[model samples]
Target chain A: MRLDKRAGLSPERCFNRPGLMKTDYRSRERRRRAAWIAFLIVPPMAMMLTFVVWPLLVALSSAFYRWEGMAQGEFVGLQNFSDVLFGDHFAALTWRAFRHNLFVFFALFVVQNTAGFLLAWFIYREPFGFRFHRIAIFMPVILSTVLVGFLWKLFLDPNFGLINQLLEMIGLGGLRQPWLGQETTALPALVMANAWHWVGFPALVYLAGMQRIPREILEAAKLDGCSGWQMLTRVVWPLVAPSTTITLTLLFIGAFNWFELPYIMAGLDGSPYGSTDVLGLYFYRTAFGNQSGGLQDFGHGNALAVLMFMFIAVVATLITQYLRRREIAL
Target chain B: MTAKAQSPDPLFPRSSPGSLIAAALLVGNSVLMLYPIVIMVFSAFKTTGEIFDAPFSIPDFTYVANFTRIWGETSLPGYFINSVIITGSSLALILLLGTMGAYALARYDFPGNSAIFMFFLAGLMLPLKLAVIPLFLQMRDFGLLDTRFGLILIYTAMGLPSTIFIMTGFLRTLPTELEEAARIDGASEPRIMLSIMLPLSVPPMVISAIQNAVPTWNDFFFPLVFIQTDARKTLPQGLSVFMGEYTTDWGMLFAGLTIAALPLTIIYIVMSRQFIRGMTAGAVK
Candidate 1:
């Protein structure tokens, strides 16, 4: 890097030096550079490969083999994948779980993002008590999902719960059904719990993005007599699209792979007629024996995991590309 | 009408009637959001009968009975210690390795630099749970299953991508003249990074630390599958099982939840600015 002639270590100086000396200097410099690169790259790269990348590769391969919890297993050659995709009970279970995931996804998309967008809009203005509001909204994000699930379970308790009690107080007791106990309401109930837990995140992100838009453009739009709706639709919305992209991309992955809240709220087996079953819980159940079944099939588990991985990898890439392109165009 | 929402001083000093309505609605909504947690904390101090009697009443602050019971009876203290160990160790490793990688990538152009950047960035939204099936098997093979050290390694590895991404972005924005001067004055690359860059990189370090640490602490899934023993369980996993077993014990459960949440809640309140800044750093950038 030191090209100046006045420098102590110049390429020209090294080249002009005597043969063995020049070779020694060049070799030493090369070695030092190599060491710097190696020191930086080796640890992080190795860890990612060993723990993350390599494990996924192993999962992909394992999906092809029939293995229980054992050191030795039979090679089944895509049988697991076929079974997961088309086999009788497993296939039905997979699709049923898939549909629930879609419902969860749709609910979160509408509830979380819309609420987030609205909250961010007001908070972005730095209105009175905005800081308090922001803190209040984001507080849940840091709590353990276990606690969130448990708290909501208490809140949704049919007999002694807050939601039902509030309904009774408001003379709408008839509208209050068993939120988590029935088939029709269980998935939505789980989704509502999840939305309650995570709604603040997208709001914060959106607020941050909105903060980045130049104040001049906003003022200029006001001067041009642009309505507030126009200001949002034409200006703020376009500018905050990146945050939208980020939120939706996360939603894409999380909704399909949703687990913890449902697991805690419902159970491992997606009790209440499997209404709250998601790929994550279902995959875990398939891999490990649950109350309904006593079979722990590693091959099928790996296959399901691989399917999830593929779906996320593909959809995540597509959404990113699509959103990023829109960002550039805007 | 609010003064700021439409005041038109090039700052959108919103002053519209709609803005007031929106603001009021926002506050109401935020209150609704916070209502449950409020109930939880208040309920902890209430007797089961009192909880049923006046569900949302202010708690009797003098009553330490529920907390005392939880502290004396439960294994929550052990789980707290376990969580601290796991989160702390993982954060330390993630920062160390992440910053090292970022420094190298930022300073020198290597083969596959962009490719490597893409590889790490791709981890941003990857559902790591998908890899759990094999990660478990691998951990089993390595005798890492049900161990704190195992959780630490996996978490450090898992968080590396986002940590590196944030750090690398931060490092790139810093002026290179200082590094150049250090090199000319006979400082080695590691020395330059450690002595100069590391201190300069503190803000991003804090951000990534919070980013990495919070999730690692709150993570229930990894510990759920990895750990088999109640003695070795992290807080979230342990709390889940504990809550299931103590379903009818509302006061103890709330007390336990409060205990589990207290440390993080305190940290956030104390460092609210930094916490907010750290959490929003990624999205804003």
Candidate 2:
């Protein structure tokens, strides 16, 4: 009753005061830590599970069943998957789409990444106009794909298009092809637009990576009889390999799941002979009927989506594994 | 700084005139980067007849007609409102849940911990469009289809991976001693988080919020699929409708595109430094 250290306990506290105090403190600490961890974890975990993880599993399961409008449909088994993989035009469509995607990847790899690297490298040497250059080049990266698409769509309107007008003014009217409407040029045009929108991101990333490289390394390279190209190839390139991995990985995923820009600029069907028809657009069309065409084949679309997912997952995993193995993290 | 600014090379020695060529090349490239936007801006001012008749010509008059016409005559205001609500609310939820989630993973050791972390990280690669059909169906079933809340929830889910990834790294970098000091001062776990760690993590939160918000505000696909009502459609989607309605209205379409793009450009200009830093931090890590 004295309200001292041992005031409230009974015979147990009296008999084992030293041990009980230590044990009680330890237990309380443990309980407090556990409670803290629990409160921090549970709600977000539950939300992620319900929304993200569960939806993925549901999508996977739905790949097998033929359903529409929430009504349970017959089990089609591997039919959907089969159609996506080995069906008559499915093979051609997927292959063609992938080929077009490969074009996008290579184009981005060469133009966007190389330009990004060069700009970052150049800007490092000359910090004048650094702020202006950074803002101007990276401006497109901040834009939404929708906005970029719309901007370019207006820019390349063929009749009132800026590019054609510029060409005409310069007496290069023959070079003014209907960029997005031509079968030969549509895919590349889309790729160019994408590269323009995306180059800023990689440039900024690479610039940061280059900045992190120790100044002494570059100085040492200079002493070692290195020119700008030699210094870049020998010192900077190897050091910035990690950034390359990130850039490539991002570009790969973006190329595969490319949807918004094409859908916006070229329409859902990718007119002028489906030249701009990426796998993403194809899946979107399949899953949800567009302005032109078929009943919404949810099952087939899910199947196609799963197929596309597997393709991307495998390629991405391989690329990541390869790049990870090769990258010498500084 | 001004003295150094006059001479281009601050770090590297200007060993040769090749540096001048490099500067020229850099300037040219920068112009390449800026030209499309420059043309787009100019095109917005050109009259429809001028757009075709003198497509390359500068506008004769600096006019407010295009801007006034789009906003006044179109559904742009409502669409803009929808975009604001969706992006703002979604960004708030994403930052809130993402930071807390990231803090838990970064600081605490728990059951299924790595597995849980991987579950979130895996979302970084799982493109949401792949699940568009099921998601749409899920929304329909839950009576969420076409609702702003539906977009918000989905966007939150979509943004979780990157936000968590970036936030986790940002939080992990904060010294654990701060939390321990708070604890030693008789602060509860929630109190420490609410008062200490959360405030310290605001920079990364702002970065993530801006990164996530721009895309959400300009998202046309989700709104296109989900929103059916004209009043409910977001700005980008509403602009698409405007484009369709005034297919040949070059002045109006360019004006709409300009309007849609202007806010993001403004935000970018204002926060370019943070945007660059935030983007690099998220990507590099």
Q: Top lDDT: which candidate number? A: 1
What C-alpha lDDT does candidate 1 achieve relative to the native structure?
A: 0.84
Q: lDDT at A166 for candidate 1?
A: 88
The sequence of per-residue lDDT tens digits that candidate 2 reaches over residues A51-123 is 6777778889999997774565989899889887788957787777778778888888998888898888877
The complex in candidate 2 yields a DockQ of: 0.48
A236-271: candidate 1 lDDT, tens digit per residue: 988888998899988888888788888999999897
Q: Stretches of candidate 1 above 4 Å error?
A: A1-20, A328-330, B1-15
Q: What is the lDDT of candidate 2?
A: 0.79
Off-target runs (Cα >4 Å) in candidate 2 are A1-33, A68-70, B1-11, B56-62
State how far residue A196 of model 1 sits from its true place (Å): 1.3
DockQ for each candidate?
A: 0.55, 0.48
Which candidate should be chosen as best, given TM-score against the real structure?
1
Instruction: Indicate the worst ten consecutive residues by lDDT in candidate 1 chain B.
Output: B1-10
User: Candidate 2 chain A, which ten residues in sequence have the lowest lDDT sum?
Assistant: A1-10
